[model samples]
Target: MSARLAPVDMTAFSPGRCARLIVKVGSALLVDPDGQVRRDWLKGLVADIAGRVRAGQQVAVVSSGAIALGARRLKLPKGGRASLEDAQAAAATGQIALSGVWAELLHGEGLTAAQILVTLDDLEDRRRYLNVSATLDRLLKLGVLPVINENDSVATEEIRFGDNDRLAARVASAAGADGVILLSDVDGLYDRNPTTHPDAVMIPVVEKLDARIESMADRGSASGMGSGGMVSKIEAARIATSAGAHLAIATGRIDHPLQALATTGHGTIFVASQGARARKAWLRGGLTAKGTIHIDAGAVEALRQGRSLLSAGATRVEGRFARGDLVVIAGPDGTQLARGLAEYDHVDAHRITGRRSEDLGTILGYAPRSALVHRSHMALL
Candidate 1:
């Protein structure tokens, strides 16, 4: 399917008003040669964020570097190339140490920091996504700063996010963040590899990204310490921007990286498209459909015209899904029109087949209230 599109302009927004922020810091900036959490760095970061809090801004910290530091701590034999499993083990070790460091630093700054380990599934499932979003919102309101990391220790390859850069973007979208600054070792994205070509220019504003722009992109440096390269950052930008959040890729080695990007715009900024509600964003990013619901011509028109699904129009339920499960709604010709939580079980749906909403009660011994799947529970597919 073609990607969903939105329209946003980063230049139109000033740095201050962007209250909800997602700040991503990479592993290269967080670990020392000995594989320890850089205490001084963590302290500085907490202090910087504390200033923002005092200014009445809400921030979410998306941090990487756990695996690298963990590997160092464990003194794992330095293999030429570490497998994904090896990285996962290292992350498991490092995640605990990383959280401790953040907690200590934030405590010193008179603030509370909470660890939120997540996997790709957390962002992909509607119920889980809403649960997480609500938790983050409540934490922010209660004067807590959330430090999110990939659930590397437990996540299998299939459910993993792979890199925190993309995770940051998703988190930003989940929180409706004003801006997402990806802090990495390099200064920002350049037209070409700057190390090989000294004249490679750092393009400042990415008004739009297309095939031409993607052609200039490259995979990250082959160093094992960092998880994301430039292309991953670009990909994250695409996700965040599409979700209606501003995004920036900037140098993390700089002191006060988050503050600098917020005030000075010292990074490559990608504009955003349209902002979606938490439910819509979750539907777009997370929920996977179990089966299809074939509808009549009238049903298709009603759905496309932004109408809800009633019992009468649902000609068939193609899958065995429990009530409250996500299912696809299809037109008679077989194109998906919407996705929503099924209100009735497959058997019940069959029992009430071809009946109107008002008829459901008489047909099934209970009166129905709203559409089979309410519009609030449905998102256009």
Candidate 2:
């Protein structure tokens, strides 16, 4: 027989510990029974976001409600299933309204909002992933909050994320967010379906997503307005934890939902597998090495000391590889030291071998990064 897992400690779920956070607001929370946007509730949530920002924590929101809101404005049916064309039309109309509301609310709080629409392809394709990551990074640095959503207007079933739960997880990983809050109709995960089984108990904390834990997830949505259910949230938890972000599933129906999550312990917190260094997670396990860099003994020592790999320390570059390709770092004695994303291509690396950082612009004909592999992007073996 297996030993019982420890009960969740509600006091540990503090937002103050997180430097960056992503919150996913569901359609059910954003739209009411009459298919109207919950303006007052949204204002409350925005105020919570403002509080987080004032505390020096960067925050992003992944929101869903465009289709439902659009359906209402277009005089279409409110609750039933919608066709693909109907969804596309609703998204086109709803996206405008969604952006306007977010802008108005955020501006009122002395914050700027940037609208970002993406599909799964944007996160899956490496080039596009880099572009999106850079854009989000810049926005955060400029003290802007990004309002991201699926490109429902143009996305087909094949390319769609299907729901915002997994999209929020992907965004958390890409943005290097330390935490994710999934605001939903339900409070948190439970051992059984609470609505059907009156004796069901809420699970406040989950340290791992084992087989038994996964089995607790239900199939269909409890909230009639959304597509994702508890099962999708579980999947999102898996993705978020693996990417080194803690995930919290909480009730969005309450006023000031984010504030409630922080103070009331009103959610299930899924602890990350480790710390919030997603790039290191990717470097350690997510990618395959495309090439190798042979470095001197001095460079090996520097890397072991948690320093970046510089071109001056590189003795040789092997194999044809492009920028951002994962490469193995080999010591002079032919022992592999680490794996990391290459900042320059094989040709550029070969050209700059044994060169100093100040000479990189002259050698490469452009201002270049100071390191061949930034320490943040490297995983020492």
Candidate 3:
């Protein structure tokens, strides 16, 4: 059985020290009863963000509401909930309308907000990752706000952020922002689920995240407006902080959630561990694998202890793979230990198993590369 846990403090997170911030607004805050866009709320939000921009703070907005807006606009058949496919379609339709609202509002403020839709793959590939980082860096440098969202229109079940909360956290880290603020319907995380436990206290701050805190989290939002809930939000915090950025979860009901989060104590703050390495964080948070490799126990220990996978440590390679395909690094026991792009195909890997690259020519009749997955291309799990 899972151990019982308490709540975290939210008021300790501050944004004053943050120069670049990522703010994710949930669907609950952006949609109304009519299932249409909430123009007034969006306008107010733009105004608030504009103030931050004027004050010399760079901001990235990760907004969610397109599906709800689209569902309402299209007036889909009466149903208790929107089908997953229906929701995806709605989001595609709503994105156009959503962007128009943002463009018009930001344009009126003499600021340009660029719409950037990305998928899991874009952030997974090192070259592509660097490319995106460069673009966001340039945008921030130029004083333009970037409005980022998942490429929901084209993403299939095989590849998705799964939700915007996770995506926002990733975006905050990808952009190298100073902090991430997740604005939701609730003010912060509770010690116990508030609905079931009347005496459940609201945690104010989390100095460190461990398995304990992760176990306390439940599933998706109870408000029914979005896919993310406390669990995903906490997962988001871990991602952001791992990327060397602070993360906060606060209520979107506040007039200026971002400013309040960055300045005063307004929500649950999850502090970063001491000097969490950036490269490892990118490996863990940025990349998604195309396949998996099963390595021996020795390989797992080496990778976990900050070493690379040697060709001799390989036990078996799984899936139809090509050179440079991102693959999972797992132990003999089948637990994922790391992720990296493969340097050879499955058949080639089988032939070269337990052999060093220098022996490739003599054993397999071909000269081989130095590493199965080069260190530069590898990321530990």
**What's the lDDT for all of these models?**
0.75, 0.86, 0.75
How are the candidates ranked when ordered by lDDT, highest leading? 2, 1, 3
**What tens digits encode model 1's per-residue C-alpha lDDT throughout 1-381?**
001111223354434567888888888788866676777776777788888888898988998878887888777655211766776788788888888888888889888999999999998885676557667876887889999999887788899888899999989866757788887877666787776777777767786888766766768643557767888888998998887777777776767766666666666778776544433555644767776678899988888787778888988878787666788888888988888877677888777767877677788887564566656567886
Model 2 C-alpha lDDT per residue in residues 1-381, reported as the tens digit of each score: 001223346554567678899999999899887878899999999999999998999999999999878878886664433677788888899889988999999999999999999999999876576567767876887899999999999988889998999999999877878889999987788898887987777788899899999999998877778889999999999999998888999888789988877776767899888765543766777677889999999999999999989999999999999877889999999998999878789999999999999999999999787689877567887
Worst 10 residues of 1 by lDDT: 1-10
Best by TM-score: 2
State how far residue 293 of model 1 sits from its true place (Å).
19
In model 2, the worst 10-residue window by lDDT is 1-10
Q: Predicted candidate 2: what Cα RMSD to the true structure?
A: 4.3
The candidate that wins on lDDT is: 2
Any idea what lDDT model 1 has? 0.75
- Winner on TM-score between 2 and 3 is 2
Candidate 2 lDDT score relative to the true structure: 0.86
Task: Name the better of 1 and 2 by lDDT.
Answer: 2
- The better candidate by lDDT, 2 or 3, is 2
Instruction: Give the runs in model 1 whose Cα sits over 4 Å from its true position.
Output: 1-15, 77-81, 275-381
Candidate 3 lDDT, tens digit per residue, 1-381?
011223333334455457888889898888876886677877777887898788888998998878777777777643113566776787788889988888899888879989888888888765566557667877988988899888777777677887788898788766768778888887777777777876776666777888878877878586687878899999898888777677887777766666555555656787765434553454666556767777888777777776657779998777877766677888888988777767677778778878876788787677665567755456665
Model 3 stretches astray by more than 4 angstroms: 1-13, 77-81, 262-264, 275-381
